[model samples]
Target: MSSEAFRAGDRPVRISVQIAPQHLPIAELRDAAVHAEDLGVDMVMNWDHFYPLSGDPDGLHFEAWTQLAQWAEATERVELGPLVNCNSYRNPNLQADMARTVDHISGGRFVFGTGSGWAQRDYDEYGYPFGTVGSRLDALAHDLPIVRDRWTRLNPAPVRRIPILIGGAGEQKTLRIVAEHADIWHSFVAPDELGRKLDVLQRHAETVGRDVADIEIGNELRGADDAKAAALFDAGVRLFTIGVSGPEIDWAPVERWVRWRDAKNG
Candidate 1:
């Protein structure tokens, strides 16, 4: 591992897409992921939900890790992982092992993006307790260290120090956890709202004794027009993600984001 520290805003703008594994044939989903790489996306992501978040309540959907393993083998580049895994679904040790295995399969192009489990329907149908928000966040806070420790103890460790991307913007608990653990912070707040959220994150970083500048800022590209994206870029968000799904996946929006990324990087 490089001794050089991580710094926010140091990297050029990178684009990623979450190919929602729902409402589409598995083959199309797989091809969409490959096509994302072909379109010049920096990362390929999938959701960790049992059912579709859009379209029919019960639609064609696939599990996250299985697809990730397949993606690791299929794509030559572009990092792969869940947009934000539900930590409650698996034991922290198991999560560590799985991520490490995928890291190896991808030849070090894997990111471990996670969050406290949400969506009550998923828990109810899947037999997990739909715990209160506070409890779930507490569980995530507790499990993260175990995951990190498990990574260290694994026989053949990860191909590299897998970047931990924590997706959430809760000022109280989530930001604090991100301060202590995350290499990347994925926030859902719009550009207008992001400044205050980042202020809160900075305070949390101070408490944890890590520089806020060391954690990369990430946001969604869905509703971001070019002007909105430029605002986010000016605000120090280094990564932008857009979500795509279906039997007929549209690459137009994706290509636009890629162009925006290239222009910004240039």
Candidate 2:
């Protein structure tokens, strides 16, 4: 699919919720996903991590790809994926294969959101090398093509052209990678920082002969209010996401954001 499709902000606002798989039981997490779908969320997401990012250091946490596979079976309408997958955790070819299988399972609702690995604890515990940021980004820049090439060779193929969402805003390397491979760029930078980073991304896109506007803009609304979200939308962010952590998943914020999205799209 060409990245030059619907500009989400100009068309409809999409709201995705990342239900963090920490401090919660499996049954509850499954139920939460079902409920989110029923509540009309546009997308559902989880993090790729071995331990809790906050709260208890060793709190209960589920792996990402496994849970994502389960979600593909459980929910029917909402698109689902890792909020941002760590590229270093699995081989690029394996990641492509897993993604293709899940895309089939979901009937083409998969969005391949990924990034270079970062969590030191995850690396130490799992025994993957903890390299410098530049090296990690270089690895990601290298692996994305392998993932794409594997996608083409897989039997039965992906249900559709799977969307690649790259998360990060490093102007030099990360943005350049987004320009090259990502259909969606998850710019975690605040609204004020978007223009400059986008300019950098555009420069990179120019070098590759792709349209920079072809990439959709995404942002997190975890610490944002309506005004902030509106500002981001005004600045061209069409994908708004909020993360809810478990064992006490809050539904109110999800509802609020859904309503906000509805209002914006209205």
Candidate 3:
């Protein structure tokens, strides 16, 4: 996180859309990506998972990085990447290479969002070690530096310093990692919970000689309510993402968020 605090006045609000890759055809996902970009979203995201998180466990799903490669080539403006990739799914070096390639494909429009692995089913079904939470977070702690180093060493290095977004709220371990590595911090907590977590993250930043303000706060827009979005914006969250899951992709909520974003920016 950077140390420059965001002034409490008017700031540009960014809206993002997360497409559930599981349950939607590639064509439909592509269409959604185009729609999101046309609708003026700041970024578009997809989750990294082998199986569907809802509806059916064995439903249609796509791999994260592979889909991102396609997305990077398909869209022209909106930044794209996983909402948060699992650190356990791939070796850090490989992940860095893949991300670098996608960054080039997108002409430098990529955000690398990653986190400690969770979801026991993803690990078990994919033959990855379904270790305890503590152990997985420990692995993530060790891998971040390796990923960073590999990113620096890769040939045709990333177009720019790709922003790193870390998603998690583990005060003791996860926030510390965010302080050390993240340019954006995503969480699903309520306003008060987010405030507390921000405090913890700030302390970690201080301990690491980093500034918490460098990290952009991210959250999901659960509804089209202006009041709710305003509360979140006032809490220091500039990047707000709303998720649309398939068989049918809904854009109404997304449109509302976009309108809210425009209002804030205007």
Candidate 4:
């Protein structure tokens, strides 16, 4: 898709902060959510996992959607969601209900970010099926539309049409699902890989008769690299995210990205 096709007038480059919830106290996590909003972050995200991805797996952890409920009550400005909630964790209808409730709690400031299950540890420890990638992606493809449909049928519908963000770079099933269901597509690939993934997504969009430009591109930042961000911006990514772990949350990188966003806006 051409960049011009996706361009909105003066849309500021958005920076997001993903808080590693496993390592922090709930109170501290709440405080961090408030602080992130205070710091002018475009969005705040938490990972969906039963154990810590970094540090000790047994150290500390929190559930994704529950934390999001607290965040919705705690913050006023920043949009919030799980970076990617595993599709196998809950019933699709239940997930939609939870997201809709949170959307109402935040007064329509929520993004429904989801993904096909990964992380063998989470599945194994939590007793969720540790299926093959293909199987998980298949489950995701089936569940996404169910979630969307459930949102419409629920007694109190979502405060807004919650934007769906599908996170992954799988060339076949995952990207195809993103093209079909996602309003935002989040991936962790490098710039070159992102270019290829965009091609895959475009191909999928063509098959579905949808415009690839309708989906927003989101990428995780490896570090503070303006040149790299520029490269990604050129590749059609507008949302850039950085992950920070607690109890020593580093706001430096986030601050730098905010500055970079401001400069880009100027």
Residue-level lDDT tens digits of model 2 in 63-107: 999999999999999999997899999999999999999999999
Q: Which ranges of candidate 3 are over 4 A from the true structure?
A: 1-11
TM-score of each: 0.96, 0.96, 0.96, 0.96
Q: Model 4 off-target regions past 4 Å?
A: 8-10
Q: For each candidate, what is the lDDT?
A: 0.88, 0.88, 0.86, 0.88
lDDT of 3 by residue, 132-170 (tens): 888988999899899889988988899989999999888
Candidate 1: segments with Cα more than 4 A from true spot: 1-9
Error of 2 at 113 (Å): 0.6
Model 2 residue 100 lDDT? 97
- Is 2 or 3 the stronger prediction by lDDT? 2
**What are the per-residue Cα lDDT tens digits for candidate 1 across 29-122?**
8888899999899999998999989888788999999899989998999999998999999999999999999999999999999999788899
Better of 3 and 4 by TM-score: 4
Clashes per candidate (backbone, < 3 Å): 0, 0, 1, 0
lDDT score, residue 148, model 3? 88
